[model samples]
Target: MENILEASGLTKRFHGLVAVHDVSVQLRRGEILGLIGPNGAGKTTLVDMVNGTLEPNAGDLVFEGRSVRGLPAYRRAHLGIGRTFQIMKPFPGMSVLENASIGALFGTNGGERSIGRAREQARECLAFVGLGRRIAQRADALGGPDRKRLELARALAMRPRLLLLDEVMAGLNHVEIEEVIEDIKKVRDQGISILVIEHVMKAITSLSDRVFVLHHGEKIVEGSCGEVLRDPRVVEAYLGRRRR
Candidate 1:
């Protein structure tokens, strides 16, 4: 299959500390690629680079066969790349439907020109993520899991061809996690390639067709879930160095 997103020799440095170092990864068209690493492993940093929040010191980012290293976040969103943040922050003082409508207003291909059409798209996304009932409620009034769903709904409203999800299952329980897994599968079914950064091993194993392991800001391994999980490097990275 063809690659939808490709990162080549990406590196990010802050002040003097290197957050990500020479990392290269790819997301295949219509596939879910899991990115797993411990805290401070430069996972979010990498995503930030991809989404245009930050620029790499030495690398190139190719999206849909074009170099998008110079594009801004909103420009990327308009170019069919949408993302959800790790910290779910819905638009303050806005209704659930209004919050999601922001995505459609500035989404793929420069978004819907009409507010009415945008809200219509938002409603469909909200319903898709089980937030249809809360459309009229204040975004800030939502609880934890609901906030997560709202985030997903907002992203889905963008109608992206590639979705970058940052730890959407972080605070959920098993059942909630399972629900998100199914939702993500449905997104993939819609032909959206996804790059997921998650700590939950079960969610990663269940959702990803292939897992990419990162350690100390570098690629440790990338393979099938079973193969990567059983690798000694991955075990040590998650746990600790095993004593002989």
Candidate 2:
């Protein structure tokens, strides 16, 4: 498979503190890569840089074999990059369908220009995420699990070639997490590449083709799930963390 994204020597700093350091990663077409790290490991920062929400202090980003380092977030989105937030951002007063419709209207390559078409696309995405019955409900009225599904549906509505999911399973119950895992698998089957940041080991192991681990803003390990999970450094980091 061809690489859809290649980030090399990526770094980020916040007021003299390094949030991410000299990280390099790749995402191949139709592959799912899991990003795992303890809190403050800079996983979200890395995702932010990739999606253009934060500028990397150094390094280059290549998407579809072209440098996207200087592109704005919208331009990257137009280039077929879509992402969900760790914190859900729902548009209050808008119904779930309306909230998702915005993604279809403004996503990749100007998205669906016609409002009617965008709504249709949005409804399709919502139904795919099992939110078909909740389409008319106000966005903010949804519970935690539903909110996560809404986030996924919104991103899916973008018809992204590459999707960055930031903790979509966070706070979800086991059943909800399983459902999302299945939904994500279906998405990958549709040929979308995904870079998912998840702390849920079961979900990550099941979804990822490979796993990358970060510690204190540094890339400590990268390998298949079994290899990385059993690495001494990874074990030590988590073990030390649990004792803290």
Candidate 3:
């Protein structure tokens, strides 16, 4: 399958601190690639560079066969790159539906030109993320899991071909996490590729087609879920030294 997104020799620096160093990865069409690592691994920085929220000091980023190195965030979104932040940033005062409508209004292909059309698309996205019933509620009214759903809904409303999800399951309980896992499957079924950065080992192992491990701002391993999970380096880096 063709790659939907590619990053080569990607590097980022902030005030002499190298946050990401010579990292490279690819996301294939219709695939879920999980990025896992301990805190301060530069996973979020890599995502930001790919999604155009940050500029890389070196390397190239290609999406859909074109270079997106200098594109602004909104331009990237218009090109079918959508992402949810680790910290969910819903418009607190807006209703759930209204927040999603913003995505439909400014997303791919210049988004919807009419409020009615945007609202219709937003409603469908909300329904897809199991938030249809909460459309009339204020976004701030939702608890943790539902807030994550609202974030997902907002991104899906953009009609992206590639979605970058950052720790969407961060604070959910077991049952809620399972529901999110299912919802992600549904999203993938709709022909969208996903690159997820997660700390939850169980969820990442279960959902990822392949896993990439990062340590100290560099990629240490990339392989099938089983292979990556069992890697000694990965285990040591994140799971700590093994017991005898």
- Residue-pair clashes per prediction, in order, are 0, 0, 0
What lDDT does candidate 3 reach at residue 160?
90
Best candidate (score: lDDT): 2
lDDT of 3 by residue, 1-244 (tens): 9999999999999998999999999999999999999999999999999989999999999999999999999999999999998988789999999999999987898888999999999999899878989999999999988999888888889999999999999998898788888888988998999999888877898789999988999999999999998889998998788789
Kindly report which residue stretches of model 3 are placed more than 4 angstroms away from their true locations once superposed. 241-244
Residue pairs whose backbone atoms clash in candidate 1:
none
Whole-model lDDT per candidate: 0.93, 0.94, 0.92
Ranking the candidates on TM-score from highest down gives 1, 2, 3
The stretch of ten residues in a row with the least summed lDDT in candidate 2 is 235-244
RMSD of each: 0.9, 1.6, 1.4
Query: What is the Å distance of residue 171 in model 2 from its true position?
Result: 1.2
Native-structure RMSD, model 2: 1.6
Question: Higher-lDDT candidate among 1 and 2?
Answer: 2
Positional deviation of residue 195's Cα in model 2 after best superposition, in angstroms: 0.4
Give the C-alpha miss distance for residue 18 in model 1, angstroms.
0.8
Cand. 3 Cα-lDDT:
0.92
Ranking by lDDT: 2, 1, 3
Q: TM-scores, in order shown? A: 0.98, 0.97, 0.96
